[model samples]
Target: MPGSTDEPTEPTPGKPSAADRAARVAAMRRTERARARRRRALVVAIPTVVVLGAAATVTAVLVNRPEPPSLDAVTTYEYAGGDHVSETVTYAENPPVGGQHDPVWLNCGVYDAPVRNENAVHSMEHGAVWITYRPDLPAEQVEELESAVAGETYTVLSPYPDLPSPVVLSAWNNQLAVESAADPRIDAFLAKFVQGAQTPEPGALCSNGVGTPTG
Candidate 1:
């Protein structure tokens, strides 16, 4: 046959050329790399956000929490008896500040009944804050008083039949009397007087004392 100049035929319509296949694979790899990077970024970012959120929550709690009462308004009294006494004694204040007290310390807990005066006075010498409410006080107020003393290492809650005020917070040489059990001053008194500077005996035990647990 006579020769004429002619171009080669193309491959099948659906078949890709080698160069096109290579380009497409490279593009797919780029897309995959991009997606992988995004996944990793999310993995790192999620925990960071959670941690930040938790920190913010904790900060808000600390900021919003109520502060304890102040002790500046508490009245100071003088008493002489750093020593323990086995005999009955009388205190100038209805709830003795510091005077003859039982040899043992009263346990730290809520009390439904009145505690012995002499023993309680002894606990004051050992750096305990005695919180006494009138026996006739409303149960709700008593609960509030109990809340004040709960979980405190050097604090006691009890009922006094004839407390001058509805509630009296007594530490060694210091006394604060409030007519309300929910008085903010009660917290203040405990904050300052529990293991306070006025304590005649610091680091004395509040538990394992002579008194039985009052339910």
Candidate 2:
């Protein structure tokens, strides 16, 4: 053994030292902590962005909205006739004139009501009298109605002039007849206008006695 040329032998196992293993574990823990921090930041940031966006949308909606008009400002009238029929006409806050039709004209009562049939029945029998006398209508347009219903005319029961603004008119026979107009009137013979009817109650006819029946 003293004369052998080989070097003294050492252990040949292939495991890491204590310091190298500890360093590797520390690096893995640091990477895990970094990933957790990223996840938490994403959760908080996404909701914050969504909430801010929703608030901005609601603000835009409120700022761009328009105010609505008041219904209480309109003037209304009630007219009566046979068969327990009655009609109500509502005038626009700003009534147009001279045979012009305004969108504000609408029938607010039942068709069987005395006043409901005034304009609807007469206009059908005669012509577009409501369109002829609207406050917004020009004199030329009113004349046009005369031409349209030249030979065939019906009675206008309301005292108000045919003009642009809603008005209620009526005719009566076996069934009550009523018509509505933003503006218009009918032309017919006096006797023929009331051929088969009785007169309506005085105050129950026009608005504050301002309109007179023409049939």
Candidate 3:
């Protein structure tokens, strides 16, 4: 059929359709949303990692901390407190952990001469630990005993005429006999017995009492 001039329709070059523009806008929105979610997740993860790291450090410290050494060789005793006597009294233990004692307590320090049993026992009531060595102990060993208790208070060191062992450390209700001044138990006994749990009269005066200390 003959007709006026007509042509097929074609899309213009270098231009997008309305549907293509709408799809690109939707894709940009999805990408921006994904980035926003990643930023939020990163914010939450940073604090969580930091908290976990701090907790791990604290746990390691607790697990690695050392425990106190055990004191097993020390000998324990049981005695009542505050039994004062004016006359000389016999004791079950040679140094007397605790028993009838003079009202006056022997002052605490080293003594070249022998300390009276009654007075020393009184000092023990006041949380004093007495270390006695046999008179025949070597001068060097005696010096070692003194060194072991250096910078310490409430300790009595004296020479005993006849000791069952070379050295004897006696507290209120505890005692340890060591053959040498170098014995490790000496320090342990002092640590546990000076104003220790066994003290019958904890915090009593070791000074301002009877018999001046030689040292």
Candidate 4:
């Protein structure tokens, strides 16, 4: 018994065999690979989210900004009358070429007497007004026109019996001209008319053209 070695002992209960240990090591390696893949995905996802957020912020800043001012205000006029006597006048600032410009013209004169003496005057007289600034007109001109003509009355001419009368209102540097068969209260009509006359830019009432600024 002293010379004989103890019989080689069997592995303790539940202790893994060499092949089982190899399989456990392979399973651990697979778990680690899965964890590493998840880590790589998170890294890519974070940067992609950051880039999209930055792009959205930049787009909002560029698209919602205000535009710069590049246009000025211009003045307009209106005239009205009947068979008796027609007259014209200005509500705000008058243009330099009131009756002698390309777009502004005065067709005021007396016509031949009618066959019936009662309606014999057959007169045609009308007034005209407008505002103009050289291409370099100052911005203050707009304010000046508005202050000068805020509540003034101007003659409106309706040349023919079948034609409607014209209503005029001064707003900013522009004039609103409306034609109707009846007369409108000055204050009420002006409130609506001015809205159309006042534009943020300098140009014609209906179309864009050269003109002075109204405040």
Candidate 5:
């Protein structure tokens, strides 16, 4: 039996070897981990891409939007107020543009009642725009004016019982009189002169002023 020449053969495999199985298991785990990493990357990347794209779109829209045209036809005056006088000062303009005015400025807001001219003049000195309309103006027109001035800082609105024009917009040393509330120049005037260059005190405070609304 020892002399028999047949080489001892390796065991015939019935199943995969332990080492092979272990290698396959490890490979599968590695593949699953790679897939999970890709998924996480995609989750993070997708939202970031969406947000960046949205921001870019908004920026483009803002950049492409048209700017308001400059208004040059507005009436100009030279009423720079360097003095704060307590006495009533008569101004050339019905609602004075700028002059010796009360120390306190009227708070900027819409008013159904008339605001005192003296206090409003002080607001103008502090770079406010005063919008005065005739008391007899239509309610609808008044509402239009109110919407225009609402939420705008350094702006005031009140009925001016008697006005040379139906509507008057006054800033420091500048005034614009419009015949109707629907006038297109109303917006132009405000855009040009609300806290505009003509203000004697360019950045003065318009809030916490002395006047209140009187209906």
Candidate 6:
């Protein structure tokens, strides 16, 4: 043993053993697997969170939306349309819901004077809501009706001679007579009947027709 060049074997410092390298590789693998699990969790969770947020938003909209008003008092009529006549046609209704209409539809807007019955009826055929009030109504009340139809293309506001009520909203065959300008039914009528289902000719041009409008 003394003559041999090889002496007692000694472990080298700053060198990893086979077991240590295997342990380090196993640890790294475990850490990588943990990271992969976390990434998968986030991938699954993000869409779930988005879906929950979207569902919550839809629920809030449904809950906060205003309920439709009751249209129990609205008077429905069965009037014939598309009857173009040249002469002044006498209608059974005071404001003339729908009957013989002029060939030209009156341009829809705010009118300070009494619009012709024949022309206005033609407008009604074209899905225009005619809001007529008595000529003698207070200026402020007249303003209220005008404001309701302001910037509206499908509405006609004018004065009618000897109207039965202070305010009368006529849409084709549908008519609603409200006593006061502040009546909620005025809005209700417009909501339900502006280019509504009962329209004889929906999407008809309310503009580019006859009569000069104040607005």
State which candidate has the highest lDDT: 6
Instruction: Write one digit per residue (lDDT tens) for candidate 2, span 3-78.
Output: 9899976533443332433343344334334444663322221222346556432122211212122222222333
Per-residue CA lDDT of model 6 for 96-214, tens digit only, reads 99989899999999888998999999999988889999999998788667666655678899998988888888998888888987675666677667776678888789988888998
| Candidate 5 lDDT by residue in tens digits, 49-161 | 35654653212221122223344655777765777878887767787787778877788877888887888988888778899999999987886776566446778889997
In model 3, where do residues sit more than 4 Å from their true spots? 1-60, 63-70
The best-first sequence of candidates by lDDT reads 6, 3, 5, 1, 2, 4
Look at candidate 1 and tell me the lDDT of residue 38. Answer: 62
Point out where model 1 deviates above 4 Å: 1-70
The CA lDDT at 45 in model 4 is: 18
Better of 3 and 4 by lDDT: 3
* Residues 62-134 of candidate 4: C-alpha lDDT, one tens digit per residue: 1122221211222343422232223433212322112212332222111111111111111101121222222
The local lDDT score (0 to 100) that residue 129 gets in candidate 5 is 87
Candidate 4 differs from the real structure by a C-alpha RMSD in angstroms, to one decimal, of: 37.8
The lDDT of model 2 is 0.28
**Prediction RMSDs, each to the true structure:** 29.8, 37.5, 34.5, 37.8, 30.4, 30.6
Model 4 weakest lDDT span, ten residues long: 116-125
Which has the better lDDT: candidate 5, or candidate 6? 6
Q: For residue 22, give model 4's deviation from the true position in Å.
A: 99
What is the per-residue lDDT of model 3 for residues 71-105, given as tens digits with 9 covering 90 to 100? 56667887898889999998888777888899999
Question: What would the TM-score be for candidate 2 when compared with the true structure?
Answer: 0.20
- In candidate 5, the residue pairs with backbone N, CA or C atoms under 3 Å apart (3 or more residues apart, or in different chains) clash, namely none
Scored against the true structure, residue 70 in model 2 reaches a CA lDDT of 23
Error of 2 at 174 (Å): 18
Count of steric clashes across candidates, in order: 0, 38, 0, 15, 0, 0
